[model samples]
Every structure is written in structure tokens, then in C-alpha cells.
Target: MSEQKKAEKIVGVKGMNDILPADAPLWELFENTVHSVLKSYGFQQIRTPIVEPTALFARGLGAVTDIVEKEMYSFTDSMNGDQLTLRPENTAGVVRAALEHNLTYDGPKRLWYVGPMFRHERPQRGRYRQFHQVGAEAVGFTGPDVDAELIMMCQRLWDDLGLSDIRLELNSIGNAEERNKHRVDLIAYFEQHKELLDTDAQRRLHANPLRILDTKNPTMQEMVNAAPKLLDYLGEESRAHFEGVQKILNHNNIPFTINPRLVRGMDYYNRTVFEWVTDQLGSQGTVCGGGRYDPLIEMFGGKPTPACGFAMGVERILELMKASGEQYAPNQCDVYVVHQGEAAQLQSFVLAERLRTAGLDVVLHCASANGGGSFKAQMKRADGSGAAFAVIIGEDEVTANTAVVKHLRAEEGAEQNQVSVEFDAVVDYVVDQIVGHGHDHDHDHDHVHYHP
Candidate 1:
């Protein structure tokens, strides 16, 4: 007989990360805060499929944009020969859904979404190939008030999250006509200093000249700085719209700076544009970015309707939260039920469910640690679970019809943290101490017996 070769072990895909148990608390807290804030503002939730037709991005985010050109995870469906792509950004998908469903046929809508967005870029801190975003869209809204409201909404969330270091940068890219005129002059001016442009800049020079203004290349800084400013070209209507947003933000006491070079990555945005940026994050990347895109509905083959929205990188915001010194105690559950022996195990299981029924999160210990049947080992696991209290049951207590509840996180030998209650009163006692329960319950059950 010949020995067989072992197969290699497979791991998760590169750049796509697993949110392990240790990191889930922070994510949950952030998500809850976002949901509450968005709901308070009357924004309903909207979910769209992760994959869409390849042409959606090509048309929505101009074909010449960097995302469409270099970063999208696109492929052809072999079975049906249909070109498909994992969405790089969600605004396009949202609009596609709105148009397809005629969701706005009656009136405008305020919507939000949170999900993973795929991109094929090289991953780094706070940026990933499979990243998550929380975004909002106000469709059929034509005024600058909605834009300012969206900005204020973000400010409120930051305040609630105890984040004070992030700052807002505001800008206006004007309408297509205004940008078109500026585009011609921009190309002419860049052409005059052709040698100073970087590879990315030169490639986008004619197709997406506005993006060239946002280049990070230090070599092209001087020329890009002096290039035609978009603000200078804003017409009367566009200038007023920009001023309207500023006026509202000023009234609301939300401070902001007008960064004339703040052109966002998307091609759909027009009129009002703003970004919440943080210097705390390395190199001052945008935490959230959005603007008014009044032409997107028409672009998606629907009636011309105005829309405004913003998307925030979840990984980046969570990084900022992690830096704020906010502590998340390792909380596995509210109650950990540890037991020994067959009789004690049966009692522990019943008590665990009763605690759960009383609205307490409970974890019943399994006899698998160390000796797989020792009280000391089970207690050790209970103490390490970060649970607030441990309910210990043993052969003696199973016979006595009582359980000893000990506080897991208390100082050693602190009698106040430890208490013993009748097995019937265990659930009520834990509920009252943990969350101040108001309901009353009675237990009238027989005990389990073991014979070997």
C-alpha cells in the first residue's frame, strides 16, 4: 500500500476579512447607532442585490472613471453569457432599483443601506477589497435643504458616537453645462504643462479632468493647484445652491471648510458636494462623501429626478471608534451556567432556558474543558467568559433544589457579588439584577435524577 499525499489547507480570500467574535461588539454598536439616527430622520431602509449588470457602472459612473477602468470585480456569466459585476459602489444600484420598481412614481423617498461593496484594489488599513459602507439617498429632492439635512444627519451621528476630531469639507461641482465649459479650459491649461502630469493624471486629463485636480502626487501639486478652479465657473443658479447649503449648515452650527478641489470619485454627483474627513486617520482620507446627483434618475432611463446621498466606510469609522479609547468589555453573555455531574447538568440546562425566557442571555457550560467533568474546570471557563454572573450547579445543589449564582467580574471574596437563590427563583433574581425586569413568573417543575 502507498501513502497518500495530503491536500493543502485553504483559507479566506485575500483582502476579505472575517469579523471575529472579539470585534463584533464594536460593529454592532456602530450599526445600532446608525440605524437609530437614520430612522429618527424618517429615512427607510432599502436593500439591493450585490451583483448587477456590467453596463450599470459603465453608464452610471462614467466609463472613463478609475473605478470602472481599474477596480471593479467584473466577469461574464458562463451559463447565460450575461456580463455581470459585483457592485463597486451602491448609489448606482440604489438608483437602478428605484427606477426598476418605480418607487418614486408617487413621490420622493428617503432611503439608506448598509452592506459590503466589492472592489479589486490593493487593501490597506481602513480600506479593503471587500469593504462595507453605510449610505443614504434622498431621491426626488431638488433643493439644497436635503443636502444640508444629510450633512447634519452625519454630524449628529458623529456626535452620538463621541467622535469630535472629524471635520467637514464642502464644495460645489455645478451642473453639467458649467463643468463642460470648465472641462475645455482645464484640458487646455493641463496641455500647456504636459510634462508635470502623472500617469493617472494624464490618463484622466481629457476624460475625467476634474479628478486630476484631486491627485495625491506631490510632483504635480504646483500645476494642479493653479488649474482652473470649478468654483470660478459656477453659474448664478449653481452658486446660489452652494450658498444655500452653506447657509443652512451655518444656521445649524455645523462648521465646514470649502475645499475648492474636493471633487468626489463618482461621476453622477452635481451641485452640492461635501465630505467628512478625519486627520486622525492616516493621510486624512474621507470618512464619508456625497453630493446632489439630479441627473442619475434620467441616466438610469427614468424621468429626470433629483437625488442626494452619502456613503461612509464602515472599517474606517470603526477604526476611528477604536482610537477614541471606548472600551468594549469582552461580553460573551449575561449569565454563564456551569455544572458538574449528570444531575447537575440537567438542572443547569433547565435553569439556562428559564433565564433566557426572562430576557437574559444565558450560556450553559458543556462538560468538555480539561477533565470534561470537573467543577473547577467549568468554573474557570465561566469566569473567563466575560459574563456578568455565573450560576454554578453541582450534585449537592441538584439534590437541595438550589443553585449558587456568583458574579464573575467582581473582586475576589466580595460576598456582595455572590448570592444563592432557590432553583425556582434563579431566573427572576438574575433578570432583576442584570436588567431590572418587571414581569413576574413562577416555576413548578419536577427535578431530574441520574442513576449509573
Candidate 2:
């Protein structure tokens, strides 16, 4: 006997998720709502490559950042032996593209992007290795108004999504000069209390003293809280910028808390920084975070340009929506075509195309291997399709060049009726019955065109 073959079982990489068809409707709803909101704000969509030169992120995001030092997926290209890294975050690539193309040479531009981002980290309920982010960037904007506007845009999105648990946490890391002074004092403070510092804090004590403030270790909480606050060291210009942002937000009646410890993980951020966090997702609380990155464009070899933007985690936002019991049901089809026999199947295909051409969604059923199932089975499928009407084409109807249109979904006490329609008039009849509108049927009745 021949040796039996062993089947290899393969699965997707850990921390990467597959969005099945059952969950696609909610994702579509979120994307559509975001696109609509962005369009209303005059933000246009921009797409950048997923892989960029390793140097771009190291320089733009700072080599000391956890994203650069620990999480980036970097490798040397086999063909050219050049170093490349899958983008951990999109802001750096967007800035790189803007500078490369001189997008802001003439003037500033508002751009948005939506795609997956990679980061190697411990996966949890709203965190994954391969996650998606929807980011909006306003380039060449210099004032506090743009900062406030970005925050307001996020508020509008949360409102549009009917999400209420998320709240805004605002802060200012000040500019390089102010942060340097604060960093000096902060490191000194941590050094004075070195014995109390945790392993994570000790490692970041000098390399990234600011990040030590964001440690979540319960034992180090008091030490981190007592560490010098960046807000205390804000210079005149920096303080004015931050206050200006606050005034605008206050005027707009957007509630927020000024969090002195909200130092973001990215290095390019300075001045206005904010995060929309929620208690709904424990431990993974930040749903959206961004701030003003004024030096990013110049750092990328372009002329000095100021930009501000924000990105929200799609999976986390969807989780919040689900937890809040938000409903999103996909729109059902207008008609399902049930057919039998060779000629009837061919006619059904033609009729389904005709209905689609008239702007109706059609689902045409193909025959099974056993010469198609009984009519009852076909009807079961038609009902399962969530169609408002079922167009039945049988041998008798095929010979007469006609169809039976049965109303599958009807109001209570309303008659669930079926009517005979001429083959040429089927599209018009379905459209009028399903859409509750009449259309001018001006096409030649003799032509029976098949789309397939």
C-alpha cells in the first residue's frame, strides 16, 4: 500500500486578525462614516507604501523610541541589499512622501489615509501586531486653531459613531528647548530616587526620561507622578500655543482634562499633544492619539512646515461600538433570482443582469450538481439572502417568456403577493415594486441580452 500523506496545517500569524464577512458590515459603516466626516472637513485621501527605508523612521521617529528601537520589522532587501522596514506608524511615511513630492511647495494641504500598521508587541483585547489606523494630517498649519480643529474633528467622529465613553486628555510637551530643560530636571529627579525606580524606569532614566512618566507599574506610580512635569517648563511661546488650543476647545464646549503625564511615545511630537482615551477597554485605553509635529517636514529635507494630525485604532473603535451595543446591519438585496432547467437558468442570468443595469442589487442562484435542488430548497436560499423579492423563472415561464415576482418581505397584514411579468418588463416591474417608484421602460422589447 502507498504511504499515507500527512496534511500540513497552516494558520495566520499570531496577533493578526481576519475580518470575516459577518464582521465586514460594521467595518464598512465605520469607514463610510469616517470618509464622510473627512470629506466635510475638506480632507483628501492620500496613500503611501507600506515599506519604507529603515532610516526614514529612525530619523523621523527618533532612534530611541520603542517603535524604532524595539518594535520595527526591519530587514535588508534581497535584491539590492538596502535596509527596509514595514511602517510601524503612517505619519513618518506621509511626511516623507510630502517632502519627496514637495506637496506643500505651493501651499499647505489636508490629507487623510486609512491602512494597516505593524508593531511587534504583546497582543491584547484591542491591540494587535497588524492593526489598522485612520489618520488625518493638516500640513503647513501653524496656529493653535489647527490643533483645536483636529481635536474637534475627533469629537465629531465619536459623536457620529454614538460613542460616549471616550474622553479627551490634553497636554503640551513644549518645544525642544523647553523639553530639554524639563528632561534635565526630570532625569535628576529620577536619579535622586534611583532606588525607587523600576527596571523599566531605570533603563529609560537617561535614554528617554519623559517616557518614564508614562509607566503603568503600580509600584513606580508615585515616583512617576512626582517626576517633573513638562508643563512646568513650557516656554513663553509654547505656553501661549497650548493655552490658545485650550481656549478654542473651551469655546467649542469640548470637555477635556489636562494630563501632565500624557507624554506620547513618538519623538517628533512637540507642543499640543492629546489623546482620546476610554475606560471601556481596560489596559488598552488610548483609542486615538496625535499632536502637532512642527519639525517633521523639515526633518525630512523639506522646507520648514508645521503639521498636526491624529490617528484612531479601527479595531479598538469597533470594539467600543460593539460594547456600546451599536447596530449596523448591511443593506439587503433588492431581488434574488431563483431558476430551474437549462433555458430557465439562462433566462434568469439575463434578467438578473437587466435588473442590475437598472440600479438594483441582484443575486442569481446557480443550479446544484444534482440538476439543482427542489424548488423548496431554492426558495429557502432566496429567503436566506435577505431579499425583498424573489424572481422565479421556471420551465413554463421560460417558454412563455415571462417571470413570477414574489414579494419575500412585506409589512404586517400586507398581502405577500406574486405577479406574472413579461420577460422584457421584469426589470421595470421589480424596480417599481421594490423601490416604490416607476421607471420609463423605453428599451426595445425583443432584445434578451445576457451579461455573462
Candidate 3:
């Protein structure tokens, strides 16, 4: 017989991925932890469109940068001739949305976002074309306290995640005029050694000279080292602002390094630029990166609002947790219901619904009457699910108006503790056993419905 080729079935796009159930718990933990921390810091959430006008990124992120020139997913919308692109980053879209919605007109807006970002890149352990980010931005605040507060929040987040071994690299790029002077000087300096620069560095030299200083090429790095430092070009106001930020960080006892060559990958960032990196990860090591973007609001047609924020890669954090042996146990339900027979199935559904209404994450499985497996199989499934207990209701239990709650984590050869509770008081009784709350305690029952 001729050799047969297997039919290919695509799962994920090149840079995209499917977050499997095994990994989704970690994602949930990371998202919820960050969201709660941001809320405690008084930051609100804002959601902008995933699809934005192509020019927004080209201008906000810089046309000369790799994001615009190479990584962006740009295409012309068939409905309208306007070119559209999936957002590569959050700041430009956030700024555009703030401008269009007049969000900054009333007062300073503290916003946060948790979503996916699009880019065209090699899919690595932590870097992906379709990656997720959790970010926060405080707009219309121009004080050094705002800068310090943002950094403190980041420190708080890393601490909460139990992620140690992270370093803070801070720098200041100064105001527009001072930065302009620095850019001019950098271009002139690199021009003298143009032949030593890479093609990418050479192209950026004319378009955005400041970017040339960020070149990773060995020859370009040598040239960059000879360039003038930004602190020397910082105008009086810029110098004082930078100092004020440092003093606040010092006051908070947050350790940081002054990386003068720390130019962010985005163009809109100005004044303060910083990155949080950890050596725990491999060569690709940046975990969080962001900075101030004072002119972005004005560029997007809104009032000149000063903004600073940072975004952390969720995948990167998870990878670090995996590597560091930092145990982050997912929140698993206390009980699961496995039922057999028509009557028992109905009883399980009713019991599951009642348990859910009482604020428990419950899973219900319908057992077939064509002879379900031995008790060992059911116990194995419950253990694999990481559930603390399992509620099994067979025909006999259903007829007796009760269900068996078996503790899944009981030691080997130990007697399984199964509790028989009244059907009417199942929800209340189970909630009490699981959460240590009395059945009669009054709690708000209003449910919130979120529309995507």
C-alpha cells in the first residue's frame, strides 16, 4: 500500500495560541490579582476598539519602529477605503478613544485594560503575535507623585505575585525641545560612523534618530556609547522633574537603576521611561515596560493631557512562575455533582443550580445508566479536576431526598466521609460547610451581567 499523508488541521495562527484549561487557571489568577490591585490604587477600566485606523499606530507608535514598519497587521477594510489595523499596543488606541469620547475633558481619567494585542513576530515561550496585556494609565496628571505612584503600583503588583528577582531600570528622556536637541546630536554623532551601523539603524537615523541609540548591533552599540547622555540635555524643568521622581522612589524605598540608554520601543513615550526585567527568564527578558506620553493626547485631537502607564505581559509572568517554582494554586470548587439515572440527573441539575446561586463554582456531570464505571474511575476524575469534594447522587440517594458529598482528598484506604443533607437545605448547608458561613446569614443576591 502507498504511504498515506495525514490531513493537516490548523489550530492557532502563527503568533496566536489557545490558552488551554490547564494554563487558563494561571491566567485567571494573574488577571484577577492585577485587577484587584489596580482597583485598590483607584484606577478604573477603559476598553477601546481592537480595530483602529492604521495611521494611529504609525504616528503614535512611530512609522520608523518595527511595530509599524514590520509587525503591524495592516489591511484595507472592504466596507470603507480607510485602512484598518489590529492594535499593536494599547496607548495610542486609548489616547484616540479618550479624544473621541472626550473622556479627559471633565477630569483626570485613571484607566486600565486587560486584552490581547496583535503583532507579527516569532512565537516564543513568552512573546507571541497575539499576546495579552494588563495595563493601567493615569492621564492629565503631570506631577512627580504620579510617576512615583505608578512605579509603586508596579512594585506592589510584582510583590503580590511573589515574583522576586526583578530589577527596575529607570530613565528620563526630557521634554520635547531637550529631546529634540538630543536627537539631533545623536544623529550627527552616528552619521560620522554610518558605515558601522546596521541597515535598520541607518534607516531610523534619518526618520527618528533617537531610535538609533537603541540599536542592539555590536557596532551600533559601540557608536551609541560615544553619544552624549540625556541628563546633560535635560532642560531646567526636565531635570527638576526627573529629580523629583527619583526622590519619591527613594522615599518609597524602591530600588532602581538609571539606564540612560533605556529608550522604549514605542515613539509616544517621553520624559520618564522605565522597564521591569528579570534575569530568571532567558534572553528575551523584559516583563513590563512603559513610560510617560504627554503629547499623545494632543496628537489625537484631545487637550494636551499628560499620561504615564505600564503594561505587563501575562504570558511572561506565567513563564516566570513556572520556572521559579512559585506555587500559584488555582481556585478550585469545593464540590462536584455526578449523577446517574433520569431522576438522579434531574436532582443533580437542581442541586448544581442551587449551589451556583449560593456563590460556588460547581461542575455537574451526567452519568449514563448503561452501567457507570467503578467508584475508582469517578474518584480519579474528581482528583484530576482538583476539586476538594464530589457530590454523587445515585438512584437510592435521589429517592431518599439526599446526596452524598465525598471528600476527594482523603488519604489512601481512609474511609470516605459522605454527608447526607436535606434536598431543600442543600445549598445553604453546603455553603456553610465550604465557606464557614451560617445558612441564615443575609447576603446580597443581585447578579451582574456583563455584555461583551
Candidate that would win on TM-score: 2
Name the regions of candidate 1 deviating beyond 4 angstroms: 1-4, 369-372, 411-413, 435-452
Q: lDDT of each model, Cα atoms only?
A: 0.87, 0.88, 0.80
lDDT of 1 by residue, 283-399 (tens): 647899999999888988898999999999999999999999989655467788988788988888888877776656677887453564577777777777767789999888998
User: What's the true lDDT of residue 335 in model 1?
Assistant: 80
lDDT at 61, model 1: 93
Clashes (N, CA, C under 3 Å) per candidate: 0, 0, 0
Q: Is candidate 1 or candidate 3 better by lDDT?
A: 1
User: Residue-wise lDDT of candidate 3 within 277-309, one digit each (tens)?
Assistant: 988777668899888889888877766789998
Q: Give the TM-score comparing model 2 with the true structure, all chains together.
A: 0.94
Q: Candidate 3: how many backbone clashes?
A: 0
Model 1 — TM-score against the truth?
0.93
- Candidate 3: residue 372 lDDT (0-100): 42
State the displacement of the C-alpha of residue 386, model 3, in Å, after optimal TM-score superposition. Answer: 2.4
Q: Tell me the TM-score of each prediction against the true structure.
A: 0.93, 0.94, 0.89
Candidate 1 vs candidate 2: the TM-score winner is 2
